[model samples]
Structures are given as C-alpha cells and as structure tokens.
Target: MTNRRSFLKGLGALPASTMLASETGFAQGIERDHFSDIGVKPFINAAAAYSALGGRNMWPKVVEAMEYARERNVIMEELQDAVGKRLASLIGCEAAMVTGGATSSMTLGTAACITGTNEELIRQVPDLRGMKNEVIIQKSHRYSYDHGVRSAGVQLIEVETAEELERAIGDKTAMLFFFFLNDAKGQIKLREFAALGKKHGIPTLIDGSNSVPPLSRLSEYLDAGFDLAAFSGGKGLRGPYSSGMLLGRKDLIEAARLNNSPHADTVGRAMKVSKEELLGMLAAVEFSLSFDYSVENVRETRIVHLIADKLSVYKNITTKVSYPRTESGRPHLQIFWDKSLTPLTVEQAQKELEDGEPSIRTCYLALSDGELEVGAAMLKDDEVDMLVQRLGQVLAPRAG
Candidate 1:
C-alpha cells in the first residue's frame, strides 16, 4: 500500500554494490570456471536462506576472519574451546559451540544428552542399546529436521496436548525437543514447554534457528529453561554454509564437543566443522551482536518497498511490503494479482523468473487465486533492480 514517494526516503542511501563481487574473484581469474567448472550456475537470490541457494552471503568480517585463520596454525581442540567461550559470551549463554549447521547441532546435542562425555557410549550411537533413546517432541513440531535428533540414535515421541506431553515422557525419555520456529503452531507454548522439561528433570532442546532481526530469541530459549539450543550460523548470522551455533549449559556444551569433530569414532565425527567455519561462526556472532538490527529491518523494508513502488504501475497487480506478524521479522513483498485483469498466471511468472537469463528466485505460494511472496533479506542492493525489472517484464501485459 506504500506510495512511490512515501517509500523513497531510504532508497537514495541504499548501497548498489554487486552481490557476487567477492565470489566473482575466483582463484583462477575471470575466464576460469569457478562454479561452472563443476557445471554449477549462479543466480540472484530474492529468497531467504534456502539451503539449495548455498545459504546467505558471509559477513565481510567473517570472510576476513576465515582468510586470516587459513594462514595460521592452531590446535583444533583449543580453537573450538576458545571460540565456544567467546560465542557464548556474545550470545548470553553459559556455553556455546560452533557446529556443522543446525542439524549437526541437533545431532551433537542429542548425543550429549545420550552419552555426556562417555567415550564408549559415543562410539555406540545410531544403535541406542541399553540407553534412554526416546526424545519427546510436539506433534505439530515434528518435521524433517527431527531426523537430525534421530541420527544421534533417539526415538521421537510426538505429542499434542499438555496431558499427552507429560504422559509421553517416561524412563526412556532422554530429552524433550522443541522446534522454536513452529512454536505458534504447537499446542505446548514456549514457557510451558520449558516448564514441562523443568518439571520432568529432563533436559530440553530447541531449534532456535532462522531468527531475523532483533535476535534476542537466541538466548530467550535458554533463559526460559531449555538446557541446550541450536541456531543456524549461515542464515541470519551470515557465516560459512557448513557452520551453526550450539548454545547451552557448560556440561552439555563440553559433552557436545567431545562427540563432534577432532574426535574420531563418534556419531558426529562425520559432521566435521573446519577451522575456517569455526572462525566464520565466531565473527558472524560478533557482527550480529555489535550491529544495530533496527537499521537492518528498515533497510530490508525499504528494499521491498522499492520493488513495490516499481510494480505499482501494473493494472491488476497489488504489492504490499509487509513483515509477517508471527513468522520472520524481516520485511517481504507479497504480490497479489487479479487474474481476470491480467493474462499472467502465478506459476507462469514464477517459472519465467527461474528460467530467465539472470535467473531470480522468489517464494511462489499458491495462497488462493494468484499470489507470490518474495523475501528481501538476502537481496544485494543491485539485485533489487534486476528483480523489479524481471518481475515487471514477466507480469506486464502483452502489447497489441
């Protein structure tokens, strides 16, 4: 609903730097195929941190830290331990460890609760013989990522109501897992879920990832009584693709480290995180902590509004720059069209964008009639123009 002039305030100061500037400078130079050498093609990201798009861009500080780390020699164990302490301090947690993404954090955290620094037990995982193998999870919260906990060799017990949760927890329950992102959809609320874990004396865990601006939710779970938590380092943190942050109690964090890389013959050995990823995660956390997220939300909002302003000329198209009330705090552009007024179909427009020369990706939702949602979080300032141009070309009516 924003008018063109009303949305033009922050537009002038917006940076127009290329999105792939750093990535373009490959080791072999311009003509050399960096990504294409392996038959991979690059595209502009108008979407959020979708894993298929290789996560978000790394923070410049993160990149610098990684480059500096690549030239130095330090003990892997020592580096992980130090980075964990620093990150914990930055995130307001008792302890934290850099993991191999959120799923890896789930696996490691599950392993920590199951084994807890026991070398023999660490070796005996994915085969939870003579162990408390059941992990209680909300029925609504049960999804693909639960497999991460399962990888640590735990059976998931799904529940819906408060009564069902209490009844589900028994002698075999190792930990109570909650998906923080899906809290609104679950019957058991955050405080209630944490209270449930506290009541049962069972350690609680949460997938506290995908938090956009105002990242106070990072520590909110632990403060609410969760014993351990995992957040994506690559998503909002803008770190290396393979990295994640695990925050929780010192004992659990120490145990998680034992069960992760630099230690062979463990379930998490395969989920190895490199030194570069470790430093990248550390720098990303630092950047997030020091950076003012308020400005970021405004920048994202302005970017989306810019797209909306450009699309305002279309006859049947209505573009609203909005921030999902209960979901991601970042601003996004939602475009709805009156199909009778325009010949373009939602799928057709989406396909054309994806299949075009400078391929642009957007969230294509079939939310009745004709609609599309495009996230502005990962858009480089320059890509905003390309997205608007491509979208205009796709949605514009054919000439007579």
Candidate 2:
C-alpha cells in the first residue's frame, strides 16, 4: 500500500543534503528526523520502481506542483475534469484521468466496461445481474494485478489462442485485457489481440505501468487500437507514487470518473487521488514529455560501466552490462561470481549493501545463476560514487 503516509515516511528518511539539493520547495531550515524518530530505515534504490520499496522519488517540479496544490480549494469534480482534459491532450489520447495507481485504473476501467454511465448499474456494481460480466485475458497475461479486474466482480475468461479467445467472447464478454510486458510469452501479440477486440466490438485495455523512458509508449497502445491503457504515475514518470493515469475512449473515461471518488457508494470511492496528487501527476507528465531522455540514458550507461569496471578486478568475478528490451529501457549491470572462490553469497552481498551505512538495495537474482542486478535509474548522481565504493568493499577478499 503505497499511500501518502508511506510516501511521507520515505521523504522524511531522505538525508538533509539530498533534500536541500533536490529543491523541493519545502520550508528552509525545518528538518525533522521523521524516519529515525520512528525507527524506519531508508536505503538507496538501485532497484526498479517497485511498490514495496515505496516507488521512486518525485521530480523537483512535481514536488513543487504538489506543494502548490496543497494551498488550493476548488470543486473536486471540476479539478478532475480539467486535469483529465489536459492529460488526454498531452498524451494524445481521447480522454484520461488520474487514479490511485495503475491498479485503481484497472478496477475503474473494468467497472466502466461492466456498467457504463447508467446510474442504476453504476450503484449496483460487483452485483452484475444482467450486465457484461466477463473479461477475456490470455492465460499468460494472468497476473497478481488482475485482482483489480476481478475486484469488479467479473469472471476472467482465460484463453491461449486467438480462436479460443473468439470462442470465449459472447454477450457476457465486457473487455479484452492485455499485459504489455507479456507480449512475447502470449500466443497472440499486441496488435493481433487488440484487433480481435475490434473485430468483436469489445473494448481493449492494456496495462503498461512502468513502461516509460521511451516516453512514446504513453500513446503507443492507444495508437495500436486498444480502447484504454493504464500507466503508473510513480514509475518512470517520477510523480506521486499513489497516483496513476487511465487514458482512452471518452465515454469509458466518463463512466470511470462517475464510478470514482466524490461520488458516493461507487466501487472507486475508496481509491482516492488528492488534489496534490492530481497536480503532481500532471506536472510529471509535462516534465517527462519535455525531458531529454538521451542525456539520462547516456548517464545511466556510464554509471553501469563504472560499477562493472570497479567490480571486475576480482579474478572470479564476471560483469556484463545488459540493456533490457523490456519496459525498463535502461542499462543494468549483472555481476556474476563463483561462490566457491568467495566467502560471500549473492544474498549475503545484497544484505550487506542493505545493512551498510548509506544503505543500498539491489536486485538479487537467484534464478540468473546467482547474479546481482544493479540498476542506475533510481540512483542519485552523488550516490553513484558511494555505490561503487560500497561494491568494492563488499566484493573485496576477506581475511582468513
């Protein structure tokens, strides 16, 4: 649950120097040891934008926008409408709205498909008596997050082939669901899957959370004919962790809004996105669209090489820099070593980094031949040198 409390706790744990350098517009000279006061430890994120890790920190402008929004008082519905319109225009989609996260977007979007703006049906959700109650998804695309869709009280019909999908669709079928990352694993590709939805007149939704940095992906699925797409505001976009964006189809988006907060007894009433979060999300999208990704990519690549080069001194250690073709379009370092030659296991090394001063968190890939994955996307510029030094110390030979 990456809520405001958790986000504030993480912010409280940041070092004063980091806070000062970030220019987040907080009152000057008012520093409180919020994490230390509560015994919560914070670490440098060398991992991806995982919810469990509190996602990534917001960009400076995003934080500023949030602060700006904190002082305003306006009609919630009007704010949603205005922000939704602005986001849709920026993303080149027909419509868009900020939600609690990608999961909330899933739930709201599913509810929209299950029961449109019909007032009676809107209040009677999760109790589908005669409405479209089935959502078709590839078996390979089935994941933990699909719980969001299931929360709408619709049965998920899983299919492996295009024919099975067509057979599965009927009067009860509401929407076609696709997980963008699992495109290769599934029997049907992205375009074909969306095309099938079009052929049958069913709406399609793609979960593309954490699929930015290329930036074009914000509109890619919509352009591919998917009626809707969900994206995380926290991941890659560097907005508030508790916020997300749902984009596409004006009517469905309208229904989603009606089913969301500021409306009583709705399924999304509890999934609240505050004014601060809304403004922050908008700022994140604007900043990300205007950001020069080429510079960031080059810097990330350099950081990966620095870590790999510094750690490659040990004879038994092997370092490989890999650029994954998946959602995370950044360079990563995979460090592999023979455990027999060293006293430290991959788990032990990761734990040491985590427990050390200026704590660090890196991916410990037990399945990748016991290698460690170091990501540069979340590392601050100054933290890079500290990370290199920490790796050198941890990987050095121990005294017998």
Candidate 3:
C-alpha cells in the first residue's frame, strides 16, 4: 500500500512559499528588472483589469503555475483535456474549455453551436450560406460585444419580448445569445429566455464575462437550463489576461475544442490559448472558488476609509466611500468638489493624476461637477498614501 505522503509526493505538488511584505507596495523584483530596456514603464493599476491596463495583477499561485507550464512542453490537447475536466468540476458544469479570452470563447462557442462536430460544417462556417445562420438576441442586449457571435457569419435577430423572441426563432435560427450581466436591460430574463430556446430547439449561450467574484454564476447558469456559457478568467479570477473559459454540455464543449486552436482550418485556430495560459486559468479558477470574499471586502473597505479620511480635510470638498456588492463587489472612494471653488476641472484633476510622477490612472466620475472615483481593489497599501497626497495637492487651498 502507498503511504499518504508518498502518494502526495507522486502527485507532484510544489512546496509553498511564505507571504511577502505588502504595505511597501509593488514587489521589488518587478522594479529590479523594470522595463527600461524596452522604453516601457509600469504604473499603479487603480482601474481593476480594464483590459487596457495589462488585465490586472494575477495571484502568486497563478503566476507560479504559468511559469511552471512555460518551463515544460507537453501535448496541448492532453493539457487542455485534463485542465478542462478539473475546471468543470470546480464550476459544477458538464464540461469546460480554456480559450484565448472571453471573446475568443464566444466566437468558438458560437462556431460550436453552428457546426456541432460536423467537420464539413466547421470548415464551411462564417460562410453560413445554406445553414441556420441566425442568432437571436434582445435588442437591449446588443452591446458592442455582439461582434463576437457575428464574426462567425451569423446574423443577429433582435427582439423585444418573449413574443418577439418566439417570432424571431424559426428554421434558420441557430442559437439564443444572452448577456447575463445585462439581464435587467433585457425584457426576457435568463430563465424565460432559456425556456424559449429549449422550446424552439435552439442552443442557448450566455456571455458571463464579468459575472465572477461570486464565481457561482458558472454553476448557476448551467443549472438554470442554459445549454452553454462562457466567462472571463482574467477579470475577477486574476488569471492570465489572455485566458477565458467556455462551459456547457459535453458534446458542445467537445465541438468547441474541435474548432479551437491546434486544429488547423477552423475559425478558432487563430484564437490560440497557450499551454501556460490554460494552466494559469485553471489555477486561478481553483483559487477564486475558495477566495475569501468577506475578508477581501473588509480589507477593501478599510482602504476606502483610509483614502476618504486623508482627503476629507480639504475645504469645500466632499468624500464618500460607497460600494454595492451587487455592482463590482469592491469599495470605491468618490471625491466631489465645487468646480467654482477649485482651480481645476475634474478632467484637469484626472489629467494631473494621470501625468503624475508615477502616472496614476483613476476612474473618472462626472467631469462637469468635479467628481472622481478610486477603486480599492487595485490600490496597493503604500500607493494609497500617494493617491491621498496627490488629490489633496491638486484640490486643496495651497499656502505659499
């Protein structure tokens, strides 16, 4: 019989490292090799994984897993298969696959619904000349991301209600596309919309990209009877920015993998998720599932109070720390002032902050009223001091 320690050793787990100093701010290691060689500079990220700012900072385990994956070469198919099964179990889904990002998953998942493991159909997609080439969507659900499904050469049929959705689906209707975050905006809710898809024999796909931090949305969507779903691994999970997840029926996920990278002559081949990114995403999902939301909320709340406390002393300025867990689930510090009483406009103040010595990028609230917002999720303990000082300098009455 194998000893417990021996079995654990054979499983290949690495030893854990001790936590490092936090209040000192960005790790010293990044500074030692700071990108002067490439004429690039890194700045503090108060924007929180906005896609334009390097997709936020990843957790230590996530980065470690990526490095480990990079140091070795393996069959891409095998790694994705193993990681996908582990990920499906984590989210309580039937199956899962890692993609280049959420948008890539959308495209691949769309193609999967369109083709469904038919090699000829897969190769002939985005040219859906003689196939069910229409995807149904709520008119209000038509955000800028509609292009992800459209790229597969399917036409988006927009509707306003359950009746409209019923009218929209026909022999040519291929899928029902729902943007989960915008549920309030759409007339037909997830359950009703999914019911319509099932009623009409159409596959349902939900874009749940930013629906994490309460990572249970993964299981929630599948449990609600939706046939397919996709999520961003980078946003709240802190995975590599390049990774996302597609989960659904085993057959759909397998069809998606067939259309995904490592398989040439398919639309998804260009949307390649590297082996390192796959492992990083898997590690992130595992970490996020057990991540302490209440503890994080407490820490972020304290950060918000610290910033608000430091800035409340300014004349004619008002600061409030507000956060609704339903929206972003992080504490935000908002500072407002009378434009006539201040020397700079909100835009000017934001520009000043953005052009500061370390180049801070903050979330701008209302510009005409001199309102600015800072999210505590991305703020380092030490950077909080600099932010407080800078805001005070720009808006407060200065003495000669």
Candidate 4:
C-alpha cells in the first residue's frame, strides 16, 4: 500500500513553480495553510464529490494551467471561443463552452433556447414577454437544480409519459430537459426524449453532471440527439469546483456565450467563470481523456478489498464490494454489521468517524439493512490506511 508520505512526495516532485507558494514573494518560499488559519478543518474525503465536501481535488496539471492563466490577460470572448473550439473538437461535439458550474450551464443553455441570439430577448430574461416561456420535463426528472433552468423565466411543464410530453409541446415550449441520473425512473428514456424534442422542433438539454469515467458519455449524449448537455468540471473531471462545460448545437452555444459573462444585462452575467477556471477545466478535460481508467479501476478495487479485509476480522462484521447503480462508475465498499454484536448503530458509527481526529466522511443509511458505503475514488493511499484503522477501531467490540 502506498503511504501518504510517498504520495505527497510524488506531488512535491511536480514543478516547484506550480506548488502553492506565497504569491507576493516567490523567492521567500512562504507557505500558508489558509484552511488552518481560518479555523475550518479539512477532512479526508472517503465519499464521492459531494459539493459540501469541497467537491474533488484538482489535478496538478490543472493547477498549473490555472496558475499559468492567472499571469496572462486576453479578450474574454476570444478565449472562450478558442477554448470552446478546442473542447468541442476533443469531445466530438458541435460546440462547447465553460460555465460557472453544471447549474450555470443549465441556466445559460435554457437562455439560449429561449433567446437564440436575439439581443432584444437576451436583455429581457426572466421576463419572457416575447420568448418561449416553457420547458418540458418528466415529473420524475425534476430536481432542485432545475431551479437554474427556471431562472431563465421558463416554467417547467412536467409529464410522465411520451404521449403527455408530445401533447405538452407547443409554441411556448422552449426546450425539453432530462436529468440523466433519473433516466431509469422516468417513463421516457434519453433517446426517446431527444426524439420527442426533435419531432417537435424544440431543443433538448440533459443535465449529466457527475456522469463521467466512461467519459464517452460526454459525446454519447450529443450523438444520441440531445441538442445540449451539461457536465460538471469539479466532479469526475477534478477541475475547479466552480467550473463546468456546456456542449451541443453551435448556434445555441453561440447564443449561450452571448448570454454569459463579458456581456451586461444577462442572467448568466452574474454566473461568471474566471479565465483561470476556464483553462483549468480545459486541462482537466485533456487529463481525463488521457487518463487510464482500467488502472484506476484496479486501484480502487484494491482499496475497497483492503478496507473490507481489515474490518472483516471483527465478529459479525461483513463487507461487500458493489458498484453503484449511479453514473459514479466506480466500485464502493459497503460495511455491514449485526447490531446485536456491537452497541454501535450505523448512524452512531458514522458520527463517531466524523467527529474523530482526522475526520472521515462516508455515506450511511438508517434502514434495516443499511450499510456504511465507502467510496475509494476520492481517497489517497495513506488515507485509505487511516480509514481502515479508524473503521476497525470504531467497529471493534467493547470489552464487557
């Protein structure tokens, strides 16, 4: 097992200039621990990129790109255009642009469908006087993030069946929105949803944030006929926490750009993505494309087994490795125990781990057959050992 020291040493071997040194005095080598100074403690993330956990760590190369971008200034529109073109080509899409986040992408994409480069309409967003005032979505697919779509002044018309969706589409319908994670729960699947949009001449948008690792899905949704798709740069891509990508129809992308930052009187003007985030997102995409998932899968599997093995020695404790039905596309360890064997409930165990020194976070459920789910995707090698030790201590039977 790789220790955290070795892992950190490997990171230190990256170009020293990319390391977080004092920006004011480069030669002084003053390193500041801001999180410590601010009294906010950082925990070992044994869970997936839950935004509350600060999303995911950015890659070294992504950090380097952001640092490089910080020192350079260019016309915002031109940089967005150039990065969009490069990203589009790489992802095999018609067009793409960086946004503040996946939610921002949804808002801008909806704005594009409503306004479509009409300057008169762009300035009148959330007013919808002369624009498409409705977006069709499945009742099951409706989520909190759709609030971003609604921010564009369009009401979400919910339907449960293909027939209802077809009938709901009208002149006021601006776009068809689908939540990729809820694909199974919805009556209409992705391809059929896109087909419905195409048959009615309405743009289709999909929120596929947190869906990567198969990475092919980036282009697969576009190829499947969705006119627009949003992916989070922070989740699987490990870019800036505030960055994301919107990809699809060229005209809509152009319209989205017009409705975004560097433009005044637009809804997306407030949802600005910095040049640093844009370049960092680009670097993340490049790194993700070049990453070896087969090796990553093996490593994650090993980590899961290691944790499971360490905890299995405790009486009545059982560990099982399972792949989630979600788009996370990684193996997770589910630790279960017979409640009679230990006084610890799943909730108590979770709280104990969280409150312990070097706090650890994992998913927990309170159901009868509940288990603590530990995801290895975000864990460091040394942290894995820490997790195993902590979990063992927590699950150990107390002496009578």
Per-prediction TM-score to the true structure, in the order listed: 0.88, 0.89, 0.88, 0.89
Residue range 227-320, candidate 1, lDDT tens digits: 9988888877788988888889999889899898889888889989888889988988776665555566767888888889988887767887
Candidate 3, residues 1-400, lDDT tens digits: the string is 1122321222222222222233223354454554877888777766456677676578777878999999999999999999998887666678899998888888888898999999999999789988889999999899877799998889999999999889877888889999986788889999998888888888999988877766567677877778888888888888999889998889899999998889998999899889899999999877665555555667778888988887777776788776633235577777887666676766788888888777787763531123577777777788988887777777775443
Ten residues in sequence with the least summed lDDT for candidate 1: 1-10
The global C-alpha lDDT for each of the candidates, from Candidate 1 onward, is 0.79, 0.84, 0.79, 0.84
Clashing residue pairs found in predicted model 3: none
Candidate 1 vs 3: which has more TM-score: 3
Distance from true position, residue 2, model 2, in Å?
Answer: 31
Query: What's the residue-level lDDT of 324 in candidate 1?
Result: 61
Question: Which is superior by TM-score, 1 or 4?
Answer: 4
Give the poorly placed runs of model 2, Cα more than 4 Å off.
1-30, 343-345, 364-370, 396-400
